[model samples]
Target: MKEQENIIHISNLEIGYPIKGNINNTLFNNINLAGSSGELIALVGKNGIGKSTLLRNISGLQEPLKGQINYFGKLKNSYSRTDFARMVSFVSTEIVNVNNLSVFDLVSLGRFPHTNWLGKLKPEDVNRTARALEMVGMSSFSRKHINEISDGERQRVMIARTLAQDSKIIVLDEPTAFLDLPNKYEIIHLLNKLSKEENKTIIFSTHDLNIAIQEADKIWLMLEDKIAEGAPEDLILNETFNRIFEKSNLKFDKLKGDFKMQKSHHRKIGIYGDGPHFVWTKKALERLNFMVVKENESGQYIKIEKENNLCKWTLIEDKNIKEFSSIYDLSIHLKLQLKN
Candidate 1:
């Protein structure tokens, strides 16, 4: 019924870097963007398309070439450095290279804006650091050396540091990069939870389009000349994703909310089955360059039968039938039969 309050706002923003003769080398221009508190936004684009540059500008690490940014209804430039540090926290893609930094000490660095000139940690600061570590599930590693943990754990520590900063907005660059599947999912899920449960505004750049579409509250899609921002479904419905990501041999599958490889095929095979096995069977058939049909309208048909939890695949063509107990065997037979 009520709109979330805007935490960050941009208008007619131009982002770029300076080159020879003080002329700006523009990467993107004429942009408008806004993000609300308690929102998770994902920024995605092809490599070298300025995703990182845009993020740096937003985090106040660098000045925008043109236009204005407002944080909490105030001009971003109005804040003192320490005051700005209290307003936003940034987690960069750069790897940590501390020789012997402990996780607790690293997380404690987030409290610098509130600490005394001598950098003394008060009781509240210690408690907040503990809570930040707990939020990222890294409390057990607090006493561990930063270099001793896995890359994924180090990433979580960086996030925990942001949490400890206690800023209203958090910006991260490629937080899931260099992580395995489980770690990627974990980090994405943690960010989503933090946005909702902690009531923090989060913006991150990522290459994981599938996770972004599924988990982010909104998406900031960086194009070659401009940026597009909207809910994931809105972008899909407007065909924006297709405009940006579609190619001759790949397509965005709106129903599956992911990309699918397209292929040219001359053979058609009808598949009849049910459940997960059927789904995977169809996938395998499609990967083999077969045009998979649902009914027996085609001359060639495959039947997937499940009995007592064991699986069987049968191929029917003309007056001949071939059966196999495993998908590998079925695939081998099909390859031999359809090698035209």
Candidate 2:
């Protein structure tokens, strides 16, 4: 198999904004990151941590305060405006809801860098635009007006526009920002597919760590002092996630690959069973500020039993024994008992 080529590289980079004369508000510094072709990279961090600034620098939309950005082994400054546009495409978080603009017309705008002065769409350009729409599953909406589609559909159209650009690298700033749960997953999944099938280098900044951890090939985790780059599993195993949220009231759960709130448990409860019922019961107990423990270690216990194709929760607290048909009943009973 051929090796994937590195398409974007940043070395000793500093990103921020100029506040006044000889003074700048640096968001981050000494940042070194790289992305290769056919890879989906997620840029994640707390809010106001420069994820968008870093993306803007990479996309050539904003200049880095100091350091170098290289594209395909060439200096970023070496590419002219048109050449840069042809090499990289950028999608911002802003939603486009222009009335009377057809999806086909919007996607065709991506071909501007390659078109003549009149911005005429040649046969090849039109074909590429159509193909881009089809790639994003927006071919059916091509004739639809931009304002007529939903937000998710509009986002797909924006991506199709970038695809039409046919750039080697694509930078997106919070592409899934205004989307619902399913749309968020769908957008990230679409990006994953594009990176693998189209072999495009895609980097997107997002606050959706769950989806990012699940879908991204690499994660650029922005820390307070530096940027950590690696696979999601690598970051988890090395406890990088723990460090990222150490200052907050959240901790990373290595086993679950997600963050959990640090809550105070007032009582200890043991839960014993097998299968999904046991798992979910434990979760419910934990959410109610109960520390789940081994059966032998706790006086209060909930035993999940299956009988006649139905599940029952048996609570044993001191000498009081009670059975509940559903977890809801068990939870309410426990809550009332603890309250008393």
- Among these predictions, the greatest TM-score belongs to 2
Highest lDDT scorer: 2
Residue range 131-203, candidate 1, lDDT tens digits: 9999999999999999999999999999999998999899999999999998898899999999999999999
Residue lDDT tens for model 2, 1-340: 2235558889999999989997999999999998888999999999988999999999998998999998988887798888999899999987887889999999999998989999999999999999999999999999999999999999999999999998989999999999999999999999999999999999999989989999999999999898999999999999998877668989999998999999999999998898899889988998889999888798889989998899899999789999999999999998897899
Lowest lDDT 10-mer window, candidate 2? 1-10
On the 0 to 100 scale, the lDDT of residue 75 in model 1 is 84
lDDT of each: 0.89, 0.92
lDDT of 1: 0.89
Q: After superposition, how far is residue 306 of candidate 2 from its true place, in Å?
A: 2.1
Q: Which stretches of candidate 1 lie over 4 Å from their true place?
A: 1-5
